[model samples]
Target: MTRSQTTLAADAELTGVAFFTGGDVRVRFRPAPAGTGVLFVRTDLPGEPSVPATIEYALELHRRTGVRRGEAEVQLTEHVLAALAGLRIDNCRVEIDGPELPGLDGSALGFAEALRSTGVRELDAPRKTLRVHRWVRAADGDAEIVARPAEGHGPAAAGLRLEYHLDCGPERPVPPQNFRCEITPERFLEEIAPARTFITADEIPALRAAGYGERVDAADLLVFEPDGTVRGNAPRFPNEPARHKLLDMIGDLALLGCDLHAAVASRKGGHALNRDLCRTLRAAATRGDAPITEAIGVSTDPAAA
Candidate 1:
């Protein structure tokens, strides 16, 4: 009875979620009074069109994740939606102007704070949930995504276990990092969520030249030089880098719009594998497949996706 699992938003609070750093852009999660689920709106536009959290609206670009409805679009929605969905928030509108979301602290912490502070309220109505009914798996070079149901998991989870293998150089301050965790809000915050976004010195020049994460500075994200943090960082949690990878996975997976419930195991999993897993999983669930518990896959010290 084990198959792949598939798993957000609308007025359903005007303030359940909100905007980022750019004063020009406004990003907020508004509740759909009709319980239409959460919808992300871009108020900067004249009409302030909406982008519902669904596969149809998601744009399938490998560079950076984005969502769209007709011509309107929102990019890098993983962080905010991940925090919202992880915190068990199911309804709100996430509105923004610009295409890319601010990299922010590079962690889900900021988004998590907003969702928790505003909070989720249960309606007299029962929430809609997607149950895992099949088995599904997708993979790319050195990356793979698998979804299965929880053994006895509750509604709050779409089981997840993410792994990362970092190969460092002689000059690299970081070592070969690896981490694993059963994805959950508590586990997310404690083990996976706090891990900050990071990039090696080798990539700094390209990032700056490409104008990536412009809203953030070295202090905001963990920019490890050949030595280490330029000045310093919150403190390396040994597995912090791997944990951060998990954080990205959580955020990206949230885009699937279902509470992921499975013994999900990912390796080298970035947005590509993460999003593909969600798509594959959603397809399986939509077709009515049962969820699985223990899955058969390589458990790398730092798993790949």
Candidate 2:
């Protein structure tokens, strides 16, 4: 739902020992003036150039998602992105000295807890929203994501319906997985954010060879084992994979450059659909386009449910 701009309370400044999963790293976030959006500055980079979390700067989405500006980029950014979007904490500087955000417990709890402990303050400034005026949609293959403003702010939600047609590996025991939930920050911390990320049994050899999650052991990520082969870490829920997909979708969609104001449902989607939809809408917006005025997946009979 669309919270009034005043509901944000105020701009905030957050500071604490930065942890990169392995342990505490050095970093901090100070509130920028309203409209600054979220910016990441890598102190570890030469002269510490900054990266703005905008669709124009999105680099790629593969085994995981990363945002970049030319050769300089950040990897596996979904966790932090999830935390920011879920918490509704807008406008802060993410200063770090690494290529990846600390994957604390494969969840957003660390970031949430740290920010909570630091406490939030009210800044004497106003917030801005990139309100949708018309509809724009995009798709890749069979997966799709769409956005349309409701008559009014009803509920703030980021949802997904992901279907894995095949298991990730020979040892994989899990069948097709899926789930639907409202996108609320409170729901995130208590019900969703704590869920650990998982990889399939079949992906292990390749992920390791690719130099991703190299420091992690099997336990750190869910590796499914069927029979003698191992599966992902034990799932907190029966359909943990799809839930994590929802988490990643919410995280990725946060880059849309605005706090959402409608119910968004995604079907069998991933970072590919997530980023594609944003780029499409953003381009339309650059040309003064608006949200889709025409109907799409919705039906003409509104009362039928």
| lDDT leader | 1
lDDT by residue for model 1 (65-98), tens: 6788765788767777767666666556666666
Report the error of model 2 at residue 193, Å. 0.7
Show where candidate 2 strays beyond 4 Å: 1-26, 70-72, 124-126, 130-136, 149-172, 227-233, 291-305
Expressed as tens digits, the lDDT of each residue in 1-305 for candidate 2 is 22322113333333222223243345565555555566777888787877777666776767557778654576666777777777766666777777666665666666666655544544454443344445545566666666655444323222222222223334456566556666665777776677667655666787667655555666555566555334535667666666677778777777765654444556666788778876665555555444432212211221211
Give the Cα lDDT of each candidate. 0.59, 0.58
- Candidate 1, lDDT over the whole model: 0.59
TM-score of each predicted structure versus truth: 0.77, 0.77
lDDT of 2 at 92: 65
* Model 2 TM-score (2 dp): 0.77
